[model samples]
Target chain A: MSNSTAFSRARFAALIACFAATSPALAQPSTVGFDQISAGDTAWMLSSTALVLLMTIPGLALFYAGMVRKKNVLGTALQSFAITALITVLWVVVGYSLAFTPGSAFIGSLDRFLLEGMVYLKSSSQLSVSHIAPTIPESVFVMFQLTFAIITPALITGAFAERMRFGSMMVFMALWSLLVYVPVAHWVWEPGGWLAAMGALDFAGGTVVHINAGAAGLVCAWMLGPRSNFGKDAFLPYNLALTLTGASLLWVGWFGFNAGSAVAADGRAGMAMLVTQVAAATAALVWMAVEWLTRSRVTLLGACSGAVAGLVAITPASGFVNVVGALSIGLAAGLFCFWGATGLKRLLRADDSLDVFGIHGIGGLVGAILTGVFADKAIGGVDSHLGVQALGAFATLIYSGVVSFLILLLIRSTMGLRVTPDQERGGVDLALHSEQII
Target chain B: MVHDDKFPIAAQLFIRLKRSPGRVIDVTWMLENELYALEVLKVARGADAESAELAARYETLLRNRKPGATAAPQQPTAFARTSSFMAEPEPVPAEVGRHYVGSLR
Candidate 1:
């Protein structure tokens, strides 16, 4: 065998050994039976699932909606809602299988397509093994994860807004979810996937969600050329109030996003929730401070954006680091993202429109790389996984960027990337819907 | 020229002036003719009175004066001959001032 192949095999063996060594023993049946699950845990999980769904449906949707010009508000909001609905159906049909089903080392097969042979009544199945809370029904876990799948592609839409055709967006989102998002999610989260087999642990979705979505967003932004008014006129956000509200919802919903990854109502989940809050708070303050020192004012919009950067940064490491690690990550994310959103984006000349790549993509990368440096075994039960984490992160970045670029090119060649200049100036809402925003 | 009654302020002012016997007909006619000429010039040129006055003064100066030796603006010299002619301000009657002051109070 080639050296790389042998190395992969050895790494896979080490992962299996590690899992076997640390695996918790199956609890024996008590006289009280499986009814011992705390009511608090069930309540928290149920609420968290709703919060995560909220993050995509209205949180991200309205956030992006308010960022675009007034003419495109309804179109942006409608597209987000549509993607949420579409992904929910797709996840039930085939997305879940490709992401979570048991298969080879690369990807899962179509055994669970259309959710065939999957019973909702049963609490335990092959699918349940992937979750920390095996007692919960696999259907619940699938629904919770489907929200993540929905938001990842929705995040990319912000990069190419105000110009892309609605039909092309639908096709691109469907393909991206299937090819890019699913494969990466599997590699990071699935037991048999290559990255997981290499001992990479993403507590939430630092690599899988933020990095994967951010890279794709950057590629899409580049492929869909700058807006017609770019550099010639100002493209300020139309409504800061709407963006503020959306950002606040994102902040609240992120607890569910990070803590819910634990899949159990345990000490680990509690720590994850605490660290996520601390990081986000610190990052918001730090970002506001930077803007004040540099720009002579503390803008509400800046604080909100900083909070999101913190959330993105802490996503991968929330489960692995202590409060100090969370604080440091937050500070770095605040400063780096301010630079990315303002200075770097200005230099690059790509109109990311909403800073999707700057905040999500760059923040996710920072979080993923730092997770290697700060991951402590005492806190998260992740030990000596730094090298594997770096490999997983780099692999995600390359795959996502390249695949996303190719997909964008294909879409551009076949259906065209940007709308006509007239259509864009008139607004996508009117162009596509034949109706004005009320 | 006949007076138009549509503009009461102008008609009243003209009637009051006509009743004042001490008013000079030659000077009144000259002023009236000059006012008519100014109005015509204003309409034709689409220029306000301020601009028209500046243009008239510039034309008069150009027609009557010689070029300066240095090709610069002509400087007023004490040795130059001066015309005694001067423009006068319009006068208001004592009763008119009293009535105007009464209206203000």
Candidate 2:
């Protein structure tokens, strides 16, 4: 480790020590004293949880589904909806324990496994609270984090959209959530984890959610190969209107995603919400301007895509940066992500079907690095180093990329990864699900 | 008549359209029709190679313009033709007038 890394670790250790000494109740992992709970924090967190979940099912589902070809619309939407259910179950089982609880420097313990220690005693008005969010009930925190878990894998589906077998996708996602997502979440969010110890500032999952999914998505696209007639024929989006609606919902719900990360109903959360809006709007306009300049005519799809790019890029910086930082991050995200989707995409020669890597992966990276540069110490109450931020972002990318590829390879050897060519041509909606839109 | 046995996909599409004769034809209808039409033609070409050759020739002919249609003197640029302009190269490419006109297929 470098000198900066060591300094970061020392600083983080001091902060932890200070917090532990000052508030023993907050540092303890097992149970929260009922008196320590904040009803206002709990209420906001509950609302935030619901809002974040909205970003997945109807939000991401519609967003992805609108972009796929009509034949695969239902199947594509089903991926998001199904992953929502799948990750919810997995998070409750062991994923929450592995990600959020205290353990070794790399992974969390099984103390919360099957929610073993979590308690809700209505008669005594007692409930469990995570060390991570001492003010809010642990149940609320789990649900909020579960929403994040659901969206990450759901985001990956965009890369291999309209190709993978449904059963194989389910299996691949299940393994990926455990092996890739859980570990990365622990590394970045859990205080004892290496990245956190190194003072990586991912206020709202730039490394954990966006970059992680982006890398995995690129791998899935490479492994699955291109959709049939990919370059030969125009694979136009089915409906831009649905896409706009989804993007709109994602915009609104991101308040919960970023602000909710604060784990409190406080000024920091308010700042996060404000910065998120500024970044998203700036990125959207920049993207539209770039598209108008390059492609000549501005399209609704391009506008929607630009807005999403902005949102993805602003995610990690929302809490740490002010409006000025948000604008700069959004601008950078728009320009870089446009190239990623177009020029970089062609250069990589991978058929990332819906530009998942282009937008999410690239946007996540830009946000993560810029967060280091633009993070206001006064606002965030912590100084961030650029090197540490880059380390966390690139580390997650490489780790997720390699692990996702291995998982895909394992699945390929066993049950196979893609639908048969005939089934694909006939449309997975009918072939796999036995349903199709007229 | 397109037979169901010969061109099942096209035949099915035709039946659907026929059943809804009052349906408003739109871009989606054209797009789907074009897709199924190509599928039928692909099968036909597989059975006999001349169909492919004829289709290629027809595509070329459709793209080619009438001889000497642009023989009349014209302005050098769109701005020169539409309004007034200084003699300078425009930074942006024109949206139309490519030598090779490719179809959506």
The candidate that achieves the highest TM-score relative to the unseen native structure: 2
| TM-score per model over all chains | 0.74, 0.79
Measured with C-alpha atoms, the lDDT of residue B47 in candidate 1 is 41
Backbone clash numbers for all candidates listed = 0, 0
Q: After superposition, which runs of candidate 2 have C-alpha atoms over 4 Å from their true positions? A: A1-26, B1-105
Q: CA lDDT of A223 in candidate 2?
A: 99
DockQ of 1: 0.01
Which candidate should be chosen as best, given lDDT against the real structure?
2
CAPRI grade of model 1: incorrect
Q: lDDT tens digits, residues A1-438, model 1? A: 596677667887866653553322322111222353445666667777898999988999888887776778888888889899889888989998888765555566686789775553334412322333464555567777898999899998988888889888998999999999998987788776777767787889999999898888888888998877565444545577888888888989998999988777888889999989999998899999998898677877788889999999999998999999899999999988888787777777787877888889889978888888888899887564566878888789899999998988898889987889868876788677554443
On DockQ, the candidate that comes out on top is: 2
Per-residue lDDT of candidate 2, residues A276-358 (tens digit)? 98888888898889978886767676777788888898899888999999999999998998888888988998889888999
lDDT (CA) for every model shown? Answer: 0.74, 0.81
Instruction: State the lDDT of candidate 2 residue by residue for B2-59, as single tens digits.
Output: 3222243333433333343321112222223433334434443444455455434433
| DockQ-based CAPRI category assigned to the predicted complex of candidate 2 | incorrect
